[model samples]
Target: MPLIYAKDGAVATFTIDNGKVNVFTPEMHRELHEALQDFVADPMIRVGIMTGAEGRSFCAGDDIKTPLPDLTPHEALEAHFFPHIHEGRTGLTRPGWEQDVMRFKRLKPIIGAVDGYCLGQGLIYLLLLTDIRLATPEAEFGFPEIAYGMAGAGGMTRLAALIPQAVAMEMLLLGERIPADRALSAHLINRVVERTGLMAEARAMAERIAGHPPVAVRLEMEVTERALDMTRDQAVDYAATLFRFQRVAYQGYGAGTGFFGTKHEAAE
Candidate 1:
């Protein structure tokens, strides 16, 4: 397998194998999926960092030469293939690696460490999913689908929501490669880091996120994904249920002071 996973203090690191630019083969994709599911189910685990070993960036996307075999290669090879997450519009008639994307959506906090060119499916892997993006100073990102006369169908829909409209349009329309700083300015990436300190920053961030209450973190991520599509009032209304009056954590009382309180009264 081209993907390698390791853990340190409630945080898991999934490193794409260095050879072939950490591309996702069938086994690699399966590894990524399993790693995600493993971390998702393990309550003790707090966060995950996806990166590429022996490189400055994360992954370069799927290796078409040796595509993942879990599903057919036809859907994977399609130019304008994607699953609609809005209004129940499943566009294409072909079978999607639904289990993969759906399984991916279940992910909470995954930070990307981009080192080099993240092309094609690699671009899709970075954008449509990962929570935080840590791009190295020397790293560049692009969806070269247009270069090959194809569209970034996998992640184009998400571009509008990830960054400003105009910038997203420029990226999708022009299909030109942009550096990490540009991505950061448009809020496409969370932070920019030096190539030398890439994984360290990602690991530190993962640790901090892991320190938060797991239940609350997981629930917020799960709910927010669905809530983002709603209108403002609908958004508010939908969010209200998450703020149930019964949960002492949301009752305006300090944590551990209301119901879970024992030896320490939560500070006001």
Candidate 2:
């Protein structure tokens, strides 16, 4: 009827619970945004996972038709949808709906456990909202906002920043739904899994990330975000001194750095 948003330890999941298609309504958006805000604020939560109930959809996008009139007024207002129409755009911040899509500067990473039929704003959010996108082989991604006579403002710009130019053009102009394998090949998705093990693999990934030094990862993301807008030389100069950072050494912040003080740092 509406939607479900729940948090468990370092993982918070936002599920599209409005029937099979998972249409984005106002309430659904509000609930999801609030849950994400909570996850972002929680020092104990290091990862967030997004999923849907069942069938071929993480979310099918906005409701194309009006709600059924047979039910009471409350039925028509059961869910709070925002992606389609909200304070995220036009510089407007409605009650309980903050500008999250562009301000997900949380202390943790958000991961999307993508499965079938991720379309329109759903794909847009997956492209920008999630730091890591792990898709099932059965998953498909698209942006059909143009077909609805509206521009996919977020996906239009964010997809290009995330993926190559050609792939971004294909998604923006042609309006085709790309499969998971294709998406992975284009670097649109980070990992691909068999449909049968999608959730398990995603949870495992979340757990692995959650087990790492939380503050380091958070600062890494934040610093890199700042670096993205800097000149190459400037970014390089800044990175030279990044290793001296010791704020993450506080008690309870230990991921032990493994053999090298941090998973990401070791990788570097």
Candidate 3:
């Protein structure tokens, strides 16, 4: 299997299993979307951890060796205009990139556990989507699409919001690999651990998140992402509204109360 999904307690894990570099093939992309769909559907799942199979790489991005679909201009236009006409070749009505972006939005607290060689779209996997990113010291962060005369789509779109414009521009324009230390210094990743301890750290973090009240965690994710576009005053009002909603909907469950009504449950 190029992609594997497994669950342990409240935490779901998705592993990219293509050997060594774990390049994203077309099938892998499809599988990823399916895995995320399953994750979203599984009510037991509260968090997800995405990592490459035990190897020196998280993912090296797309496999350039895979041959591109040979579609003529008219066929391509027709495929774009009427997806059902070319559903067999294209797999779905929506492009994989858009599907992936939506999948990312739906998954709560998806953690990217990068070990090595997180490049191109692989880097975007962390930058744009993942809520928490942890990497090993030997990990590499780069956007090498420029070398192939291609431009990145998702990563470039959201990079400036996550990191400084100058730094994001450097990575996008230069097509150079930055070391994990540099990435950490630039605040691109949350933490960098030794290679041997990388998965342990990531799993520990995921377990901690899973142990939290799922509703509160998800609400925090929703508010943070949505608040990015809101003005400060608007965000403050929105957050207050969410606070009331949480208290009402969750019965003050996550307001630091204890299990079995041991701790004082705040009155509504």
Candidate maximizing lDDT: 3
User: Where does candidate 2 have its weakest 10-residue lDDT segment?
Assistant: 90-99
Query: Where is model 2 more than 4 Å wrong at Cα?
Result: 67-103, 154-157, 247-268
Estimate the TM-score of every prediction: 0.77, 0.77, 0.87
For every model shown, the clashing-pair count is 9, 10, 0
Candidate 2's residue-wise lDDT over 130-246, tens digit each?
Answer: 778888888888877776677755444477787787888888778778999899999988889877888788888888887666656766777787798899998877765564554
Q: In the order shown, what is each candidate's alpha-carbon RMSD?
A: 6.6, 6.9, 3.9
Clashing pairs in 1: 26-68, 56-115, 57-114, 57-115, 58-113, 58-114, 58-115, 61-122, 256-261
lDDT at position 83, candidate 2: 30
- Score residue 248 of candidate 1 by CA lDDT: 49
Candidate 3 global CA lDDT score: 0.76
The clash tally of candidate 3 reads 0
Write down the worst ten-residue block by lDDT for model 1.
259-268
Native-to-model Cα distance after best TM-score fit, residue 155 in candidate 3, in Å = 5.9
